[model samples]
Target: MENNTWSDDQPIVSIQNVHKSFGALEVLKGVSLDVMKGEVICIIGPSGSGKSTLIRCINALNDIQAGSIKVEGLEVHDSKLDQLELRKRVGMVFQQYNLFPHKTALENVMMAPIKVLKQPKDEVEKRARALIEKVRLQGKEDAYPGELSGGQQQRVAIARSLAMNPDVMLFDEVTAALDPETVKEVLVTIKDLAEEGMTCILVTHEMGFAREIADHIYFTDRGVIVEHGPPDTFFDNASDPRTREFLSQIL
Candidate 1:
């Protein structure tokens, strides 16, 4: 197991005693994690284990009721923190390829950099083209969403996120919508990013992929992180009964 590069000196994203809820349902309970710079972390658990909520909270997409989240030293839970700036620093990709119907692939990738970031059109276009190519979508830049396959659309969405040039990338079940055959292409693109030292936090169920690529794995259960370790220790020597049961069912 070649555990690759990661910085332990400074954490890029920090989650401390994070607790979130939806009315009576508490989704995340006292979950804590510190993702170092250039680290790749895969979060695995059954549905409704607060994995998605945790990732959302990291990007300040959802507010945490208790505890705090900090991204690149910006306190996410602080009322004074500019969520706009936080989002620019933390890019997130949802499972659904939320591309606009009227916009072509290149347009979809360039829009955010132009409108939101206020980057120059020519500069943004240049960056967008590079991002699209990086995601392996060079040939289909002008194609509409209707023209691309689900996997291709997802790749476009990934390129769209990269266009922002965010410091941390958060993926929430990115390949969940793609058909089994199409899943590999999207996974390959993600793996490439991970290998290139992008600080990434993934909420996914791809156990084998996680084992192969993740520097660390966090197993969440019933709104808590029940077990966590590097891939070797987390995958092969799970200490908790819940972790063992989950691995047995999934693996």
Candidate 2:
């Protein structure tokens, strides 16, 4: 970082010595990481190991008290940064799916681009249709969230995020609420996105899926990253005993 050569090819996300607290409890303690363009980073650990908090902080869902998080060269921790625009660049899909319950699938996908970005309705619809198809929900656009299965609804949520044309996508336990059979469909769509070289940060418990598509894996614990490396190395021979224990319970 000191060489400054990376300035020409700045990282898509740069988190430096980030720390966050809630009242009396410290959640993130001096955590730091960098994500290069198109990199797929899978964050995994025990339930309370700060996995979800870290990803949420990336897009500013929870503000950090110390250190800095920069996305596409803008410091997120800075008060001057445009949070609304930042979210446009860094999209997030949560475990709850957060789709509009009343709106049909296509409308949920089309609403943001039209209302937030102020794009032409015709143009937004064109792209929304393509995104719906991309998520393998081609024929379900007319269905409401209540009519679709959990997996289908989540896919629509994913498509809604993609409609924003984000530079990076964050997945927070995306398949956690789905039935076992429903999980595969959502995973397949995410795998396709990874293959297409979209910069992604996934906080998930699906060990097999994470091992398959992640370019690098970060194992965090006690508000710090304890281990990080390529899938083969870290999964096979993690540097820490705590990482081994966590993987054993889930894997």
- Tens digits of per-residue lDDT, candidate 1, 1-251, equal 02323235768998899999999999998999999988999999999899998999998778889998877777888787777788888888899988887999999999998999899999999988998898888889899999999999999998999988888999999999889999999999999999898999999988989988899999999999999999999988999999999899999
Lowest lDDT sum, 10 consecutive residues, model 2, at: 1-10
Q: In model 1, where is the ten-residue run with the lowest total lDDT?
A: 1-10
- TM-scores of the candidates in the order shown: 0.95, 0.96
Cα lDDT of all candidates, in order? Answer: 0.90, 0.92
| Residue 64 of model 2, lDDT score | 98
Give Cα distance to truth, residue 87, candidate 2, Å: 1.3
Off by over 4 Å in 2: 1-8
lDDT of 2 by residue, 168-228 (tens): 9999999999999999999999999999989999999998999999999999998999999
Model 2 clash tally, residue pairs: 0
User: Once model 1 is optimally superposed onto the true structure by TM-score, how far is the C-alpha of residue 176 displaced, in angstroms?
Assistant: 0.8
